[model samples]
Target: MKNEIDKKLTDKNIKPTAMRQLVLKVLTEQKTATSLPELELEFEKADKVTLYRTLKTFEENKLIHKIEDGTGSVKYALCQDTCECHPQDLHVHFLCDKCKKTYCLNDIPVPTINLPIDFSLESVNMVVKGVCFNCKK
Candidate 1:
Protein backbone atom coordinates (compact mmCIF):
# COMPACT_ATOMS: atom_id res chain seq x y z
CA MET A 1 0.00 0.00 0.00
CA LYS A 2 2.84 2.39 0.84
CA ASN A 3 4.55 1.53 -2.42
CA GLU A 4 1.37 2.28 -4.35
CA ILE A 5 0.98 5.61 -2.56
CA ASP A 6 4.57 6.52 -3.33
CA LYS A 7 4.13 5.65 -6.96
CA LYS A 8 0.95 7.71 -7.20
CA LEU A 9 2.73 10.76 -5.84
CA THR A 10 5.71 10.25 -8.11
CA ASP A 11 3.45 9.83 -11.14
CA LYS A 12 2.02 13.26 -10.41
CA ASN A 13 5.57 14.71 -10.22
CA ILE A 14 5.27 15.19 -6.46
CA LYS A 15 7.87 14.08 -3.97
CA PRO A 16 6.51 11.40 -1.66
CA THR A 17 6.76 12.73 1.84
CA ALA A 18 5.53 10.90 4.91
CA MET A 19 2.60 13.28 5.48
CA ARG A 20 1.67 13.19 1.82
CA GLN A 21 1.77 9.42 1.79
CA LEU A 22 -0.52 9.26 4.82
CA VAL A 23 -2.95 11.76 3.34
CA LEU A 24 -3.09 9.86 0.04
CA LYS A 25 -3.67 6.61 1.84
CA VAL A 26 -6.58 8.04 3.81
CA LEU A 27 -8.12 9.64 0.74
CA THR A 28 -7.77 6.48 -1.35
CA GLU A 29 -9.31 4.32 1.35
CA GLN A 30 -12.33 6.55 1.82
CA LYS A 31 -15.54 5.84 -0.13
CA THR A 32 -16.64 9.48 -0.14
CA ALA A 33 -14.91 12.81 -0.62
CA THR A 34 -13.17 14.19 2.49
CA SER A 35 -13.04 17.63 3.99
CA LEU A 36 -10.16 19.29 5.83
CA PRO A 37 -12.00 19.18 9.14
CA GLU A 38 -12.71 15.50 8.72
CA LEU A 39 -9.08 14.78 8.00
CA GLU A 40 -7.96 16.78 11.00
CA LEU A 41 -10.20 14.69 13.19
CA GLU A 42 -8.70 11.54 11.72
CA PHE A 43 -5.16 12.74 12.36
CA GLU A 44 -5.35 14.19 15.82
CA LYS A 45 -1.58 14.36 16.21
CA ALA A 46 -0.96 16.01 12.87
CA ASP A 47 -0.49 19.75 12.60
CA LYS A 48 -3.29 21.54 10.79
CA VAL A 49 -0.86 23.70 8.83
CA THR A 50 1.07 20.69 7.59
CA LEU A 51 -2.07 18.88 6.53
CA TYR A 52 -3.48 21.94 4.83
CA ARG A 53 -0.24 22.49 2.96
CA THR A 54 -0.14 18.85 1.91
CA LEU A 55 -3.68 19.09 0.54
CA LYS A 56 -2.82 22.30 -1.30
CA THR A 57 0.21 20.67 -2.85
CA PHE A 58 -1.86 17.68 -3.92
CA GLU A 59 -4.39 19.97 -5.58
CA GLU A 60 -1.66 22.03 -7.28
CA ASN A 61 -0.04 18.88 -8.65
CA LYS A 62 -3.34 17.46 -9.87
CA LEU A 63 -3.14 14.51 -7.50
CA ILE A 64 -6.54 15.47 -6.07
CA HIS A 65 -9.53 17.55 -7.11
CA LYS A 66 -11.77 19.73 -4.97
CA ILE A 67 -15.55 19.52 -5.04
CA GLU A 68 -18.00 22.14 -3.83
CA ASP A 69 -21.07 20.06 -2.97
CA GLY A 70 -23.29 23.11 -2.23
CA THR A 71 -22.91 22.40 1.47
CA GLY A 72 -20.49 25.30 1.95
CA SER A 73 -17.63 23.06 3.04
CA VAL A 74 -15.22 22.01 0.28
CA LYS A 75 -14.29 18.36 -0.17
CA TYR A 76 -11.33 16.69 -1.77
CA ALA A 77 -11.07 13.43 -3.66
CA LEU A 78 -8.29 11.57 -5.36
CA CYS A 79 -8.13 12.17 -9.06
CA GLN A 80 -8.41 9.33 -11.54
CA ASP A 81 -5.12 8.22 -13.08
CA THR A 82 -6.18 9.62 -16.45
CA CYS A 83 -7.40 12.91 -15.06
CA GLU A 84 -5.29 15.96 -15.85
CA CYS A 85 -7.34 18.21 -13.56
CA HIS A 86 -8.61 20.08 -16.59
CA PRO A 87 -12.13 21.23 -17.25
CA GLN A 88 -12.79 18.57 -19.90
CA ASP A 89 -11.44 15.84 -17.66
CA LEU A 90 -13.88 16.63 -14.84
CA HIS A 91 -16.99 14.48 -14.24
CA VAL A 92 -20.15 14.68 -12.19
CA HIS A 93 -20.26 14.52 -8.38
CA PHE A 94 -23.17 13.43 -6.21
CA LEU A 95 -24.00 14.63 -2.71
CA CYS A 96 -26.19 12.46 -0.53
CA ASP A 97 -28.60 14.47 1.56
CA LYS A 98 -29.16 11.79 4.16
CA CYS A 99 -25.59 10.70 4.79
CA LYS A 100 -24.16 14.08 3.80
CA LYS A 101 -21.47 12.35 1.83
CA THR A 102 -20.17 13.32 -1.57
CA TYR A 103 -19.22 10.79 -4.25
CA CYS A 104 -17.46 11.07 -7.53
CA LEU A 105 -19.38 9.56 -10.42
CA ASN A 106 -16.46 9.24 -12.76
CA ASP A 107 -18.27 6.90 -15.12
CA ILE A 108 -20.80 9.61 -15.92
CA PRO A 109 -19.06 12.22 -18.02
CA VAL A 110 -20.12 15.83 -17.79
CA PRO A 111 -21.97 17.00 -20.86
CA THR A 112 -20.40 19.70 -22.93
CA ILE A 113 -22.20 22.99 -23.03
CA ASN A 114 -22.64 25.24 -26.05
CA LEU A 115 -21.80 28.70 -24.84
CA PRO A 116 -21.62 32.01 -26.63
CA ILE A 117 -18.47 32.74 -28.56
CA ASP A 118 -17.52 35.36 -26.04
CA PHE A 119 -17.92 33.00 -23.10
CA SER A 120 -14.81 31.35 -21.77
CA LEU A 121 -14.97 28.33 -19.51
CA GLU A 122 -12.37 27.90 -16.78
CA SER A 123 -13.83 25.11 -14.67
CA VAL A 124 -17.09 23.25 -14.19
CA ASN A 125 -18.70 21.65 -11.12
CA MET A 126 -21.90 19.64 -11.39
CA VAL A 127 -23.26 18.20 -8.14
CA VAL A 128 -26.44 16.17 -8.02
CA LYS A 129 -28.05 15.92 -4.58
CA GLY A 130 -29.97 12.81 -3.50
CA VAL A 131 -29.91 9.92 -1.12
CA CYS A 132 -27.02 7.52 -1.76
CA PHE A 133 -27.44 3.74 -1.94
CA ASN A 134 -26.04 3.21 1.54
CA CYS A 135 -28.37 5.83 2.95
CA LYS A 136 -31.38 4.23 1.28
CA LYS A 137 -30.51 0.89 2.75
Candidate 2:
Protein backbone atom coordinates (compact mmCIF):
# COMPACT_ATOMS: atom_id res chain seq x y z
CA MET A 1 0.00 0.00 0.00
CA LYS A 2 2.85 2.36 0.78
CA ASN A 3 4.49 1.58 -2.52
CA GLU A 4 1.26 2.33 -4.36
CA ILE A 5 0.84 5.63 -2.56
CA ASP A 6 4.41 6.59 -3.36
CA LYS A 7 3.88 5.84 -7.03
CA LYS A 8 0.73 7.92 -7.10
CA LEU A 9 2.54 10.91 -5.68
CA THR A 10 5.42 10.50 -8.08
CA ASP A 11 3.02 10.22 -11.00
CA LYS A 12 1.73 13.65 -10.09
CA ASN A 13 5.30 15.01 -10.03
CA ILE A 14 5.22 15.31 -6.24
CA LYS A 15 7.96 13.99 -3.96
CA PRO A 16 6.31 11.38 -1.76
CA THR A 17 7.31 12.37 1.76
CA ALA A 18 6.19 10.28 4.74
CA MET A 19 3.44 12.74 5.69
CA ARG A 20 2.21 13.04 2.09
CA GLN A 21 2.05 9.28 1.76
CA LEU A 22 0.16 8.88 5.04
CA VAL A 23 -2.33 11.62 4.19
CA LEU A 24 -2.90 10.34 0.67
CA LYS A 25 -3.36 6.82 1.92
CA VAL A 26 -5.99 8.00 4.37
CA LEU A 27 -7.89 9.85 1.64
CA THR A 28 -7.70 6.92 -0.76
CA GLU A 29 -8.81 4.42 1.83
CA GLN A 30 -11.75 6.47 3.01
CA LYS A 31 -13.40 6.36 -0.45
CA THR A 32 -14.94 9.75 0.28
CA ALA A 33 -13.99 13.38 0.66
CA THR A 34 -12.67 14.37 4.09
CA SER A 35 -12.33 17.62 5.95
CA LEU A 36 -9.41 18.88 8.05
CA PRO A 37 -11.19 18.38 11.37
CA GLU A 38 -11.98 14.78 10.41
CA LEU A 39 -8.38 14.23 9.41
CA GLU A 40 -7.15 15.84 12.62
CA LEU A 41 -9.09 13.28 14.62
CA GLU A 42 -7.55 10.49 12.57
CA PHE A 43 -4.02 11.84 12.92
CA GLU A 44 -4.12 13.15 16.44
CA LYS A 45 -0.36 13.34 16.74
CA ALA A 46 0.18 15.20 13.46
CA ASP A 47 0.80 18.93 13.47
CA LYS A 48 -2.06 20.90 11.95
CA VAL A 49 0.33 23.11 9.97
CA THR A 50 2.11 20.12 8.47
CA LEU A 51 -1.16 18.45 7.48
CA TYR A 52 -2.54 21.65 6.01
CA ARG A 53 0.61 22.22 3.97
CA THR A 54 0.54 18.65 2.74
CA LEU A 55 -3.04 19.04 1.58
CA LYS A 56 -2.17 22.33 -0.13
CA THR A 57 0.73 20.70 -1.97
CA PHE A 58 -1.48 17.85 -3.14
CA GLU A 59 -4.04 20.31 -4.48
CA GLU A 60 -1.38 22.34 -6.24
CA ASN A 61 -0.04 19.16 -7.86
CA LYS A 62 -3.49 18.08 -8.96
CA LEU A 63 -3.16 14.92 -6.87
CA ILE A 64 -6.45 15.82 -5.16
CA HIS A 65 -9.42 18.13 -5.65
CA LYS A 66 -11.37 20.23 -3.20
CA ILE A 67 -15.11 19.99 -2.70
CA GLU A 68 -17.21 22.88 -1.47
CA ASP A 69 -20.67 21.55 -0.67
CA GLY A 70 -21.91 24.83 0.86
CA THR A 71 -21.32 23.23 4.24
CA GLY A 72 -18.97 25.95 5.57
CA SER A 73 -16.05 23.52 5.76
CA VAL A 74 -14.12 22.46 2.66
CA LYS A 75 -13.34 18.82 1.86
CA TYR A 76 -10.72 17.11 -0.24
CA ALA A 77 -10.92 13.92 -2.25
CA LEU A 78 -8.62 11.89 -4.44
CA CYS A 79 -8.91 12.76 -8.07
CA GLN A 80 -9.49 10.19 -10.79
CA ASP A 81 -6.34 8.74 -12.35
CA THR A 82 -6.79 10.82 -15.49
CA CYS A 83 -8.27 13.85 -13.78
CA GLU A 84 -6.47 17.11 -14.41
CA CYS A 85 -9.29 18.84 -12.50
CA HIS A 86 -9.74 21.53 -15.12
CA PRO A 87 -13.16 22.99 -15.77
CA GLN A 88 -13.95 20.48 -18.49
CA ASP A 89 -12.83 17.65 -16.25
CA LEU A 90 -15.14 18.71 -13.43
CA HIS A 91 -17.90 16.33 -12.30
CA VAL A 92 -20.89 16.37 -10.03
CA HIS A 93 -20.54 15.93 -6.25
CA PHE A 94 -23.17 14.58 -3.89
CA LEU A 95 -23.47 15.75 -0.29
CA CYS A 96 -25.49 13.64 2.11
CA ASP A 97 -27.27 15.94 4.51
CA LYS A 98 -27.79 13.18 7.05
CA CYS A 99 -24.29 11.77 7.18
CA LYS A 100 -22.67 15.09 6.26
CA LYS A 101 -20.48 13.22 3.81
CA THR A 102 -19.42 14.33 0.36
CA TYR A 103 -19.21 11.84 -2.51
CA CYS A 104 -17.58 12.31 -5.88
CA LEU A 105 -19.90 11.27 -8.67
CA ASN A 106 -17.12 10.61 -11.09
CA ASP A 107 -19.28 8.63 -13.49
CA ILE A 108 -21.61 11.56 -13.93
CA PRO A 109 -19.84 14.21 -15.94
CA VAL A 110 -20.70 17.84 -15.33
CA PRO A 111 -22.66 19.34 -18.18
CA THR A 112 -20.93 22.05 -20.08
CA ILE A 113 -22.36 25.50 -19.71
CA ASN A 114 -21.85 27.91 -22.53
CA LEU A 115 -20.75 31.15 -21.00
CA PRO A 116 -20.75 34.51 -22.69
CA ILE A 117 -17.89 35.20 -25.04
CA ASP A 118 -16.56 37.81 -22.67
CA PHE A 119 -16.56 35.40 -19.73
CA SER A 120 -13.75 33.00 -18.97
CA LEU A 121 -13.98 29.80 -16.95
CA GLU A 122 -11.23 28.39 -14.80
CA SER A 123 -12.83 25.92 -12.35
CA VAL A 124 -16.33 24.64 -11.68
CA ASN A 125 -17.95 23.24 -8.53
CA MET A 126 -21.39 21.66 -8.61
CA VAL A 127 -22.82 19.89 -5.58
CA VAL A 128 -26.19 18.20 -5.19
CA LYS A 129 -27.32 17.97 -1.59
CA GLY A 130 -29.86 15.45 -0.36
CA VAL A 131 -30.18 12.26 1.64
CA CYS A 132 -27.91 9.58 0.23
CA PHE A 133 -29.00 5.99 -0.34
CA ASN A 134 -27.43 4.78 2.88
CA CYS A 135 -29.17 7.51 4.81
CA LYS A 136 -32.53 6.63 3.30
CA LYS A 137 -32.02 3.01 4.31
- Candidate 2 lDDT tens digits, 1-137: 88899999999999989899999999989867999999999899999999999999999999899998999999999998998988877999999989999999998888998999999888889999999999899
lDDT, candidate 1, 1-137, per-residue tens? 99999999999999999999999999999999999999999999999999999999999999999999999999999999999977789899999999899999999878897789999988889999999999898
TM-scores for all candidates: the values are 0.97, 0.97
Question: In terms of TM-score, how similar is model 2 to the real structure?
Answer: 0.97
The global Cα lDDT (0 to 1) of model 1 is 0.94
Q: Score each candidate by Cα lDDT.
A: 0.94, 0.92
Task: List candidate 1 stretches off by more than 4 Å.
Answer: none
Q: How many residue pairs clash in each candidate?
A: 0, 0
- Provide the lowest-lDDT 10-residue window in model 1: 107-116
The true-versus-predicted C-alpha distance at residue 108 of model 1, in Å, is 0.7
